[model samples]
Target: MFDADWPHRLHSAEQVRALDAQIIAAGTPGFALMQRAAAACWRALRKQFGEVGALTVLAGSGNNAGDGYLIALLAQQAGWQVQLYWLSEPAGLRGDAQLAVQAAQAAGVAMQAFDQQAEANGVLVDALLGTGLSGEVRAPYRAAIEWLNQQTNPCLAVDIPSGLCADSGAVLGAAVQADITVTFIGLKLGLFTGAGPEYVGTLVFADLQAGETAQTAPSVAQVLTSDTVPRLPPRSAACHKGQLGHVLIVGGDLGMGGAVLLAAEAALRLGAGMVSVATRAEHVAPLLARLPEVMVKAMRSAADLQPLLARASVVVLGPGLGQSAWGISLASAVAASDVAQVWDADALNLLAAGTLRAPQAPWLITPHPGEAARLLAISSAAVQAGRPQALARLCGRYPATVLLKGVGSLLAEQGSAVSCCVHGHPAMAGPGLGDVLSGAVAALWAQGLSALEALQLAVWLHARAGEQLGAQGRGLAASDLIAVMRRLLEEHAPCRT
Candidate 1:
């Protein structure tokens, strides 16, 4: 569960530095803030590791190293054995970092030059790199990071894991795989997206008493939490099925009937007033058998889809929509319709293939990395390398709200800050999940939410439901999320009031 008090706003590295500067300019000494950050990290360390007596601190030239030196001093002062390894020369540190080194020297903390031969004594504290890194990590630091990852000793990262890009979450070579990462000031957008989640084990945040300063600073993104996302409006006592809006799920080629069924069921369960399925003639029976609430129609061609498209307030396109002629014709028809839409699977593929133009209607696109890569004409690796940038580009290119699905799912609209959902579980990785998410998005939009709002809420609900169900372990089927999503939606927003 997401804590209401956790900061919702996420910043780029430059933005956080600016906020730090703002706090410094507002009367708080830079060294004082550094000390506060060290104190907070030390407290978290003790709380998590329970007074682990020996400490190994890796220090570099930046202020990140300053935090490490201060933490070493704190550990030494507590009578614990502390070994400080300098990857960057300590004599060259300036400003607050220099002060931290001086204080550590006065405290008599043992310091040595970092080398491959140096054994990790106990808990490893990584402060080798901060958010200032823009290019690939260099020699000794990279070696040190590789060494740290090879160690069995528990590790704690100050601010962020070394080598993880603060702006993009791309590993600039190799990054520290820490047991706990204590981040300070502002939450970096990188921490929750791209490759950040794998390296960041348990994330801990401290404002260094600069929340007020941060609140006034500009942020690049916002985290989607139960508290931060919008809720569905209450339904009137006399609300009728016709008033709530209809959702039409279009897809399900011959062997892929289950995909459309999952999507249609998700729409109905998510509170769509009416649900309909336009699929292959062969799928109508199984779909009706599974979910009779959906008005299933056999779509033979674009002409067969017209009547269903006319009645739908929102259309969920491509759940198992293969690249066959039948699928393309229907996709073209949906693209021409003015109904709000949620595009996934084959619909996105068709768009990427240039078979369908970007829709003019209010729309949301849910694409995994492969689909996103296709849409951008880039490698999937590139899409994952800079998910935020890719998502921004996707939003800019298409008029629709874009939802890039992966570890830390991101949703973006043209003028709004990118929203990230960090609640999903690894066990939820399976087929049909995207189909369910598309249905959820359409269902929410049908209920009066805008495309962006629907995408945000749907992403949150889907991820949280996956988290709750995924705790039971692996083999999490896609349909497993539907009931949980329904329950969660009701818990978040009741129909009655």
Candidate 2:
């Protein structure tokens, strides 16, 4: 079996740099490390693009350039024609960059300046920029990045693609589009989030002994992949519904009943012992028609909502919830309840508007970037620009576990480290996806997983299901996750027959 723990550990560029220093201080030469990085890139390049005859390196002025130069040297020595374009002046290069240029020269690797006349082709190498980019990409570099992007050749980014922020995954003005990106040291958190996935092709990691030997600093978040998918203990034959937990889904105002139905169905499918829906009176019959197992109730006043809230082991207060009177009435009631709950959709919007109070119970909030921005009172762009800081602020303000939904969905609670789910599919960017997620989370929470544990597993389950269904192609309806969720739950937590 593969190690479940290692791949989930992601580190920031700063932490990775610190690991490099630790490795160097332990008596390994920095140049040797650079050589190892080049060799790893070479191996990955050959694996990805077999028997290429010609290669082009877009070299910059950092250690990233060093990796590119040595890659050019390796290609040149392998009897392949290699061309190097200096995105920065080759003469003024210093440190490892200069050593790389000198070694390439010794190896008869030719280098020249990038210009309008430059034409990059035949398996390109993007070493134009590396980690630690703080501002938008400047012009000359931007032009080179633009040129590199136009090339049709299969490209390899040495460590990370140039112009891709190693921290936030934001594409700085412009970035390289690679066929594959071979990263070193630690798998960057940025690569799984933001624009990282677009710019970073098939991500290949080379820890260069850092996985075990290099002393890595504590990470900011944990990545969720298949190996890290947690499972519940097997159930006994004597197990009953009461041993499991009941979940209440409170949303689906008149026109939005379908969303609440989806959530309720997801909860039931994911093993919630019993599922109830406290929604618009008009939605009850349809809810029952769609999901016969769900006990549907009409929720008009707080009196109607509180009884459902009182009985449910977990409450999911969102999904098809609008910002109107009926939505507000039930949401406000749920806000006041102390049941472990999930606040999503209109619940989040109303909570940000201060109409619905923050929950006093062990609760979780599922907010997309726009909702997160509203909750933090910041711009959505700002939220994307600095997601980690935004997540920290959300955790600080709400006193509830915050699940910020996006490319790399993040989950965090007070006093615990954040976890990122990199398993979601782009097809899930539909209207009702959040509702389904809220229901799955509520079911897990009701089933006795702590907010963190439930979130870690639930988010993975929801995303992995989306990925599976999404493979069927676009127009992936939210209901597509239903059967996949049941199959996954059974696979992970089956009854001992």
User: Clashes in model 1: which pairs?
Assistant: none
**Model 1: number of backbone collisions:** 0
Q: List the residue pairs that clash in candidate 2.
A: none
Expressed as tens digits, the lDDT of each residue in 175-271 for candidate 1 is 9998999998999988888899899889998999996778777998888888888999999888899977899999999899999998888889998
TM-score of each: 0.98, 0.96
Q: Which stretches in model 2 have alpha-carbon errors above 4 Å?
A: 1-6, 214-216
lDDT for each residue of candidate 2 in 1-497, tens digit (9 for 90 to 100): 11244466778889888888888888878888889999999999998899988899988887888899999999999999899998788778888778888999999998888886787667999988888677889978998888888878889998888888888887778889888898888878888887788888888888777656533467878887656656776777888998789999988876999989989988988888999998888988888888999999998677887777778899988888888898898888887777888888888899888888887888888889999999999999888877777888999999999888898888888888888888877788787877888888888888878888888888988888998888888899888887887788787777563
lDDT of 1: 0.91
lDDT (CA) for every model shown? Answer: 0.91, 0.84
